[model samples]
Target: MNEQLTEQQINAAGHLTIGGCDAIELAHKYGTPLVVYDVSRIRDQIRRFKKVFEANQVDYAVSYASKAFAAIAMYQVAAAAGAHIDVVSGGELYTAIKAGFPMDRVSFHGNNKSADELAMAIHHHVGVIMLDNFHETDLLSQLLEENDAKIKVMLRITPGIAAHTNKYIQTGQVDSKFGFDLASGQADEALEKVLANPRMEMLGLHAHIGSQIFELAGFEGVADKLVEVASHWQAKYGYQARVINVGGGFGIRYVSVDHPLMPEEFVDAIIKAIKTAVAKTNLDLPAIWIEPGRSIVGPAGYNLYTVGSRKDVPGLKPYVTVDGGMGDNIRPALYQAEYETVLASNPHAPIEEHVRLAGKYCESGDILSQDQGLPATKPGDVLAMLDTGAYGYAMASNYNRNPRPAVVFAENGHDQLVIERESYADLVHLDRPYEQQ
Candidate 1:
């Protein structure tokens, strides 16, 4: 079976306790379909990333990708850890600011940022703005001219390397909708435009291959390509970038079959590749920056759901339904993601049979897992889906009118509520009465 739970989650007397708090007890108190995060685990991931780069004497900046798990409390954690944050939208930026995160440590990113969004980032004096395309460049230039303000920026580049991962998550390919395509000379054009403009200070270049990437070859290849591009710029325009922001996609173990490199290993491999490429091209070594979202917080989360119904098929696999489904976690439906499901009430119970874990949503595609082994599950048993800390809550929706679940932070055996469960009144809080004549 996959070790989906974090180090803080342990089985004591056949019960699961995450961060020293009993999972089953927490389920009853906080209600089923609750998300509990291990704050210590999150901090540990951050430290590991920083430690690896710092030990190599490389100037580095680690930014938390807030779109993975954006919450006020998560922002506070990143700020407390002295890490930067990557916000792709205005709402996330607002959350980071409301949480008192330093504006100098914030980075704004998006493919199609509007004029208003650019104004918001500039008004807040955000640390960096990752320019995605030509339209944004034109829009930002106009906005800066109007406001008489300057902002640091990076050009997002599509390196044309297809990562060996899901097609849905690949963002660095030449045919992607994200960054300037290098194969078509769009990247060079974008760089030229930014260099000529005086309003925006071009900090460096940024590229993100994809998410849940497991191989080191992809990282090394991306480093090589990016360095080559930088070298081209150096020779053509006598320009040297001070920073190289390679966005993160380090994969975590969601199933037993997945054997991914540790954070240290991933960092070492990428750094070594960049060093070699820079040396070959006789270029300056730029400060490295990474924006990790899932790897930092994925393993630290546990989604607790109460089993509600069981259906037995004559020959096909039996199905066990949980209170939560795609409404709270849409990864399976969207990315065809697989996760390990364990009975929180019986963590160590022997796998008596294999069954289909179905979500309570009305859609047939709401199944979380199929042919997964469980310990003869019962209706009241609490099922804990491991490794949901990344996209679980962030992608949750009110499909089928299902209210989103609450969230809690567990640390030192104490659990604190961070987000309250949505109530029925909240569902209709914006609904209008039907008494209009």
Candidate 2:
């Protein structure tokens, strides 16, 4: 049995279960290449993050980084757990609005936010705008003035802290394109601009080290640097920060080797770091905010696909292909991400072979897992890939003209479809003929 699947997750019939629903039955009902999320896990992760702050007697906000997996149902689930959310584009903001999410709890973030996107945020009265550069600050200032409105603004400081991840995943570096550079006084310049604009309410500072992070040292260093900047700004311009958002990169367990800290453990470490740093200065303790995306929902998501074909070569590992591939989940193809796959019917079965889990995509690099240990499987047998909730469906495309998989939410022994599977009609709905009258 793979250690990832506990005995409790295995039902009496020896079949795997997710959120109290049989994984095999879900495959039959929702069809193969389906994306399912255990709703309870999502809520529990949020509560775990919140309980840490409540126990420590500190103000905090567990903002869901929606770029990981933004959907109407996901937004509703985050809202039900009393969480704030970080929206990076107009589409995400619109999704939040459609979900009836509280506009006041939304923090808009983006590097090259257009004037139209800024106007949409203002019209919606989002909670805060994380100013990424001087152009954004000026454009936001102009938008606020034109709308005759006041909006909370936070300066996103590029703290130059390097979090351990893929080169592309590290966004907190001094040379990154995401936030204002701190070393070159770009952060200070943006702050001065925000302070000069009457319609922009300077609230606090925000910085994200990176994504899928595991070490506490990176967050600790970031916390110290954030407090140091706040103290320096206060001493120079008499400005006090009300919020300090240490953006989330808290990692989650994808494979057996990935040992992620518990949500409470991560939150506790972050809280202690901020408190220790604040104690060194005259500044009041600011509310600590974290934007958790992968940590909150990654573990809860499972991608179920049906085995379709097999390729065997002498003296080489067999290729066990599934019906779905890079089109539905591009992480593996995009960044060589790893995941654990098991037989949906019997996860505890003896491992018959360790084979290459191949996708249906035409790209040779679209392998889901280089090595997956599983029992003997035949065509039509279902396989469930674990921990694919983060950027899977959120980045789904119509590659190879394959219709994307449907999404389902299963909890308390009940299941409901969330995102309907794309149909051939839906794909061609946006097309128009040049010869049309």
Candidate 3:
């Protein structure tokens, strides 16, 4: 049995259940390579993060990083959960607008934001623009002056502390490509620039350590570093920050070996660290904002794939191929990501053999799992891949001209199709025959 599943997750038919809906039935109805989300899981994680801040009597915002998984339905669900959102691209912002989400609750972020995207964010009155570079700062300043617009902004600084990654070195120089480096005084330089522009309201500072983080030391280091920066700005420039955003990268359980802290634990630690840091300074306690993309939706999502063929190599792990491949979820092929899989019909069945879970994509690297232990499964057996809700569909492509899979939301014994499967015509909808002159 997969450790991620509980006894209650198995229905009377001996099949895995998602949000009270049977996984087998979902596969039959939606077809293979489908993505399913347990809506309650997302809702609960958001609420839990909020309650922790509220319980501590601290003001906060649980901003969902939409880049993890962006769609109109996802935006709607996030809005319903009272979550602010972080959008890196215009398409995600447009999706949130189409979902009727409040624009003021949106934060636009990107390393190199286009002029058009900045114009869109300002025109729509997005809550905050995470200024990443001096070029972007100048561009936004010019655009704001031309449009006579004003918007709240934050300086994204590289605190140089990342956990569970090779970039864990914390110093003045950062190895990332995202934000302004603090050690080089670029963060201070950017701040002075933002303050010079009347159209940009400098709210506070922002930093993202790393993704798939499992430890708290990195976050604690960042919390203290952000406060140190804020204190320096307040003392030197007489500037007071209202909000401190330590950007998202919270980890979630993709396999049994992963043991991430609860959302409450992570929030509580951050809150305490900020409070403790504030006690050492004359500055007021700023509102803490956390962006949790993977933690909020990763555990809630599952990918269902239907088995198609098999190849038994001599004395090697048998190849168990499925209908979907890198086109649907490219994490495995791109970065050698790991995930657990189970038979939808009997999630708790005894392991019969170890097989390589291969994808149907043409690429030789389209392997879903290198060594997946599973029960005896024949053709047409549905395999439920766990913890794929974060980066799966968001990175899906029309590789090999395969249409992306549909997405479904299940809760309280009901299932609703949120995103429809792309049609074959959709693959060529943007095609135009070249006319040689």
Candidate 4:
């Protein structure tokens, strides 16, 4: 599966160095179980995606889906790279606001937004609010009318195109919880209700099929379906959606078994599909928007863990335990996903044996990798797992009283700690003891 490290990434000590910082040194300074993001790689990815849209003559808004990894530093980096932010929750919105992200460039999305959340979005003057259902539309309209605020909104529709990915992430299917159903005439009704609201300006239609999708055909399918609905709206009401957001599910190369399409190629293919569909529909081209979370930041991140324990299971396999487990990375146990790992302390070591990577969690199922071939590992050896920036920390848990790991950025030979390691006291910071009378 070609699990060797790149030559340019190898350092004098025979260890992998990302963003000009040695992984081993980073582990020592930031402590074990650290997430190190390569800022240059993230910026380059953003530019590559944007360039393809620009070249294809597609007016687009490339929003970084911040649910992948939302932090002040990450938000700032994404904003600085000229990518609009897509926040899915109130907390994500707060983070972006604290990072001083331009509200005009931010888009808020959620399936069930509370009245307070709607009010916050109105106060912040976010660029767009992607309404997921009739309830949200009603709530947003009420808030806007009561507060005398006008909002730009997009109707999120389920296009009934089931993407090839984990079933948990599929959103465009008819029965999915995310968007308005397109097959049952509910989407039309929702559109009618949205248009009736005087305070809300319906800007567009948005659809996200699923996540971890590897082929471009699925996206093409989404584009076709969206254009079909968009044409109907134009014909019925003479109101063409100004923007069409085909939400992002561009996959990444998690292991050799998966061959994900490149970001630029995926974007180009989607653009071509949209143009073809629009040509047939005889409708004006709307500004296309994409919300890419994983592809933009996944490969740019590497999680370093210090080996802590070793176990030899008779007639089964050897187990190498690290300081972190499902608490930090739940993909392995959650999705039965595979990840490639290399020894940061000995990047050039030959793969000599197969070992199961276990996390330091109480659950027996808290494993990081199963039946993985790597160099004979020992305690204190640093292991680097590639492509962890997307969901690793964002989905992290405090299970088994394990504190979350720290996050850092390594760029141009300089390493800066972006998030401090959670301390034991930080664990119970929200707890309070009751005083008995």
Candidate 5:
């Protein structure tokens, strides 16, 4: 029931075509359980964020949170769009580097970054390091001093304001394990330590409230809190914050009932709050940087699955199974996430009835969605799930020995395979044979 699909998605010959390519055809070519991203949609999102900041006549940087879908192709796409890239792990950092992304535009983030990881970031001369806690501050300081390096850093602070999202995804709340807490005076301690360290250049402050945030008040609350902290620090230490990396968690429409703000509207609201806070605190406005992961790629991503088996219940809910399930997208099982499903082979057909979408996984709770209406789905019918572009692929797993599906980027009537589907051999490539031992 969610109208979350991209605008460019159309019905052609009674089949779904995303970005001018038939979705069913793409499944046949790339194989089922495929993730097809509309490249134009992604580019549009990048441009949307840029236009919003530029329109406000403010210094800003839009960094694509690559943890949503850490693919080399996506990194290249972000780079081409003139957006910075945010890598949360060594693997993501390596992927961004391998994609030939500008090292100076890459930011390394994680609460528990290892020594090797910090060294990797320092070695590559990454643009900024979003330090999450005291452990990271000490580890990174030691690593930088050891290497005789001075790098730009941002202290990830917990503004103690919780967004109205799922509690599991909330990060900026006081009880969260992510950043320096403001209420306990940990933020001030961390700021002092960073300023006293010669190897660390405190560029700004960072705070991520939560993902899938719909209310603008949460954004404004954090902005106000962070600016207040910045003002205090500026006065106490005579150190001016140059940038404020307010981490992104803007919610996207997954179901029809969910009404989230547009990119421009969201950016405008946050900027207005920052301006007000800056004026109230009598502080200089710092450059705003956002790391949007879901909003940028959520609607642009469509997941295609091949119908497999079905179980009829006569009166109770019938079960419709797909070739891929929680293995390819664990959100439904993990977060009880809901999605709108359409028959790619017959998208325009009249609705027949509602059926429960069952995953091939062995778990009983591997249901993608319950009571989803479709046009008389049958075996071999291609089912496309809307708005799966954010955490679906990033959270995919190899549970039950199911190989992960391939990913493709579609645009201008063509599709490019970005990630190859896993093979049976690949499943055990790292295993040591008992016979060998």
Candidate 6:
């Protein structure tokens, strides 16, 4: 059972421990269907990414793309760890503002930003606005002109590099709904428009290849393309762009089949590629910015659930149903993602049996794991799923009218409940009952 735990995690006293907290005990005290985050692991990941920038001797901003899992507490933690933040919508920006995050350290990004969103960002004095399309540029330009505010902007470009990942998560390819496409000259046209606007400051270019990418080749390819574009721009314009944001889609290992690069290796590969391309093109190093979401927080989170019922399908498979399902974690149902699970109450048990992990949701598609190996499972046993820190709670929905799970932070043998469990009344708080007159 201990062998099944990740290198940074441990199992003690027939209980799972993450960042040194008893998982069973945490579930017992905090209640089942809980998201427990390892504070130390989050800090360690932040430091690891920062060290990469330091090692490369490059001015960089490692922005935590909170779209992975954004909450007030998580935003504050990222800010305290000395990392900038990336918010895609007004809701995330509002949460960050409520957390009192530094306005100057925030970067706003979106393909379809509303006027109110742009106004909020300008009022907050956000550091950069990552323009996604021509409409967004025009809208932001109008907002800036009206407010008479100076805003730094980065042009998000699709470099036509399709990374090896799920097609749904790939963003750098030609067909993506994200950045401006480089091959069709849309990226150049976008840059020209931004440069023409006095209120909109053309900082640099940004390109994101994809999500959950295991290899570094995609990043290297994008870096080469972006640097070439930047050099060409520098020759046309008098000054070299001051910033180049290689957007974040670095991968994290969710199970045995997935193998993502470590922070050091990923950063080193990008830096080497950028250096080579810049040297080859005779251009100076521009400030680098990365918007990593899953990699920074995925492994740091664990979803703790308690087994409620067990059923064996004759000769097909055994099903272990937990109290929570798609309402708390929808990745399995949405993307057919696979996850590894362990019985926290029987850490020493030999995993010799295969079981299908199911959630309590009424939907048949609410399966968490299919044919997952585990020690013989029993009713009332506590189980934990690893690498859920990214899309788990962030993508949670109140399907089947089930309330979402609570989130906790644990470190140094101490655990604190950061988010209170949602109640039935809380779920309907937004509803207004009306009687026919």
Candidate 1 ranges beyond 4 A from true positions: 5-8, 434-437
What is the clash count of model 3?
A: 0
**Model 1, residue 171: C-alpha shift (Å):** 0.9
> How many residue pairs collide in each prediction?
0, 0, 0, 0, 0, 0
Off by over 4 Å in 6: 2-12
Lowest summed lDDT across 10 adjacent residues in model 2 is found at 258-267
Tell me model 3's lDDT, rounded to 2 decimals: 0.91
Off by over 4 Å in 4: 1-4, 435-437
Comparing 2 and 4 on lDDT, the stronger one: 2
Candidate 6 TM-score, C-alpha based: 0.97
The model with the greatest lDDT is: 2
Superpose all Cα atoms of candidate 1 onto the true structure and report the RMSD in Å to 1 decimal.
1.4
TM-score of each: 0.97, 0.99, 0.98, 0.98, 0.97, 0.97
* Tens-digit per-residue lDDT, 102-147, candidate 1: 9999999999888888899999999999999999999999999999
Give candidate 4's TM-score: 0.98
Q: lDDT of candidate 4?
A: 0.90
Question: Number of the top candidate by TM-score?
Answer: 2
* Candidate 3 C-alpha lDDT tens digits along 25-54: 999998878999999999999999999999
lDDT (Cα atoms) of all candidates against the true structure: 0.90, 0.92, 0.91, 0.90, 0.89, 0.87
Clashing pairs in 6: none
Q: Compose the digit string of candidate 6's lDDT tens values, residues 224-254.
A: 9999999988787664878878888888778
The 10-residue segment of model 6 with minimum total lDDT is 1-10
